[model samples]
Target: MRRGRIDYRMQRRAVLAEVRSGVRSVGDACDAHPDLVRAATHVGAPAREPCPLCGEDDLRLVTYVFDRKAPANRGGRAVPRESLARQHERYGDLTVYTVEVCTACHWHHLVESFQLVTRDTAVG
Candidate 1:
């Protein structure tokens, strides 16, 4: 794939989602994708869905993706900043959303949103 051919959005979404869920350690996330932490910290989160970074509500969903393996076509993928687009082709179907919140504080700007379609994974 060409340099720009890779999908950075999906890559970052996968990484960020893992961090937000606590499934991936911050240190591990950083170690695995050094650029991810830096990019995430710098770029800020999206404005849709709940603010994953600060858990705020006033946000907007910008980028929405559909889970590739989703049985009903509704799946969410966590993505980080640095690993965007080029992370992997397997992430083709993962849905990623970029949101922006309306908080005066510059600290809280954007967040990522994900949805669980199935009951088993949604609640579990």
Candidate 2:
């Protein structure tokens, strides 16, 4: 079982619905920060789907892990997926946020957020 896991698929669907229904403009939906866009190009992993808004095949996913208890330089950085286990081991308690980015259109969204807890540090 996933401990402290939270999925944001529903929220993603809602935002897509609004964009599709014309309630929210495409500009608003695709407004990703410059830093995020840069990360998408440099460190992002390939996403399964194409850009939902632009229909480009430039979608990527970037995982950012943050731990308030960690030193300022150690927290709030994008880490590779392959090293997540190592990160959890080092941080003990961390919050991870996965973001989907379309480098083509600068579109981005929060894919999911979850808490990572080491076995020793997790509360029952």
Candidate 3:
């Protein structure tokens, strides 16, 4: 299959709809790995909405930031949404991904992603 930008909002809605329709169980959907669980628990921000997977209120939003100039092995960093402006200033060309996770069931999904740099700036 061809790879391209993803419409995360649509994808999230579809998954949630499936859950709501009883087509899929939240427990089954939440199959997060140990490291992902750890990151979401420690670095993620608490979300206002409940977990779509398990209907738990312990959902968190974990953000990962990436830049072209950053080292391959050490580029992605979990950061807070409030710090995006500062990160954008520091990393001229950056892509940010916000993922929602359920601490209760290890359920995770990408909430959103976007380029954080100004349009005039050159990205490589």
Candidate 4:
């Protein structure tokens, strides 16, 4: 696919459908079927969209995050209530992304902005 041709809305619908089916948790489903993740997080813009840094209209869609990612519950210790805010501060959310390389300058760029569904929000 050219990246520009993917439909994000439709892809999300499919994922949501699976969630409503009670077949598997969203996390499990996403792990098993990464395509859903890809579709939900894929970024697309005009063929000649300008790069944010270089302002060149040749930038391509790279990668993205679909939902939010939770912080790693380290060491099996119960997290202190005071640390909850820190956890959120440390890991804002789950994200998916891709890299775009400049053909002319060989400059590589990563686009990471897709938010992932938090563990709290998603099923276990």
Highest-lDDT candidate: 2
lDDT of 1 by residue, 45-122 (tens): 544455444455633333334454657745543444334453335454344555343232112222444432222232
In order of lDDT, best first, we have 2, 3, 1, 4
TM-score of 4: 0.26
Clashing pairs in 3: 26-53
Descending-TM-score candidate ranking: 2, 3, 1, 4
Better by lDDT, candidate 3 or 1: 3
lDDT of every model, 2 decimals? 0.43, 0.85, 0.78, 0.38
lDDT of 4 by residue, 1-124 (tens): 0122233545545644666687546444323133322322343333345433345565444443332333445212223323434444565543344444333222333433233333345344
TM, every model: 0.26, 0.87, 0.76, 0.26
- Lowest summed lDDT window (length 10), candidate 3: 1-10
lDDT by residue for model 2 (25-74), tens:
99999999999999888888999989988999999999998984877777
The sequence of per-residue lDDT tens digits that candidate 3 reaches over residues 7-118 is 5988888887887789988666788777777888888889988876667898999888898578888758888777888888888667788888888988888988777656
Cα deviation of 86 in candidate 3 (Å)? Answer: 2.0
Where model 3 places Cα greater than 4 Å from the true spot, the runs are 1-7, 18-28, 71-75, 121-124
lDDT of 3 at 109: 86
Better of 1 and 2 by TM-score: 2
TM-score of 3: 0.76
Error of 2 at 90 (Å): 2.9
Q: What does the lDDT come to for candidate 4?
A: 0.38
CA deviation > 4 Å runs, candidate 1:
1-65, 86-88, 102-124
**Regions more than 4 Å wrong, model 4:** 1-56, 64-95, 118-124
RMSD of each: 13.9, 2.5, 5.1, 17.7
